[model samples]
Target: MAMLNQVSSQDVETLYFNHHGWLLGWLRRKLDNSFDAADLAHDTFVRVLRKRELEALREPRAYLCAIARDLAVSHWRRQALEQAWLETLATLPEPIVPSLEQRALILETLEQIALILDALPMRVRQIFLLSQIDGLTYPQIAAQLGVSINVVQKAMVRALMQCYKVLYRGG
Candidate 1:
């Protein structure tokens, strides 16, 4: 068992040595950020190691690229969400605006909520945002979205369940 573990470790080292530079370069070009590319390259191997199936990866580079691409997409989505959130904050009433320290805390919480919402379907995401953030009624949401109230209700339920799961995942 110990010998097997050592061999497995050696295989991962070999894989990293062979592909890390090429993967980093590719990701750097794609992301246009050396730091993020390096982090993603590291994360790709970390995921492989976490899976404990390095030996099973026949197309290693392809596997790495796929993971890297998904991570890149996730990063971009988070960036977009942050930009939208900041724009929304900028338009808030001065009286209701949070203090600087409170704003930081709120932004962090909003980022968590964004990640929770990220897993939702596109329509579900839209409906949930409309109802929760814009204070839309079910009928209003349905009309705006061109769907029945029942469909809007179902989407709200699903979106809320996902948010619930994310919020209570540790519990």
Candidate 2:
């Protein structure tokens, strides 16, 4: 059992030697940026090492591809979010624009909020977005969605609870 759990440094080195080039090439084709591809390839191996599932992997390439794919998707989402934020900032007056440090902090917070919001159920997320982003009152949202005000209120409560748990309680 102990042997089943333990993968030696040599094993990791062998795995990297065997698959690194293939993984790098896969990422390069997927990302169209050699630098980002290289970074994701390294991140994939780091994830593999941290997981300590080397001995259990029946198909190393498939496992690597799955990790790399998730990383690539997250990379793309973050890039899109940053681009949107930058465009919004561009519309602001120069004097009111955030400093570089403030911008980074805001971006990070937005990413966390996006992740939280994405985890919400479809109806709940829709209600939250309508209320927050569209500035619609509960009655307005209920009318728009053809749901009762009670249902909309309940969904908002559920969504806010999810946010509270994840953001405040670290759940």
> What RMSD does model 1 have?
4.6
Displacement of the residue 129 alpha carbon in candidate 2, Å: 0.7
lDDT score of residue 49 within candidate 1: 71
Pairing residues by index, what is the TM-score of model 2?
Answer: 0.84
What lDDT score belongs to each candidate, Candidate 1 first? 0.84, 0.90
Query: Which stretches of model 2 miss by more than 4 angstroms?
Result: 1-11, 52-55
Q: Where in model 1 is the C-alpha error above 4 Å?
A: 1-7, 53-55, 80-104
RMSD of each: 4.6, 3.0
Clash totals for all candidate models: 0, 0
Give the alpha carbon lDDT tens digit for every residue of 1-171 in model 2: 322456667767888999999999999999999999999999988887786545566787997899999889889989999999999999999899999999999999998888888789999999999999999999999999999999999999999999999989997
TM per candidate comes to 0.77, 0.84
Expressed as tens digits, the lDDT of each residue in 1-171 for candidate 1 is 212232266777888999999999999999999998999889988876776443455687997899889888878876777788679888999897778898778767877876777789999999999999999999999999899999999999999889888888841
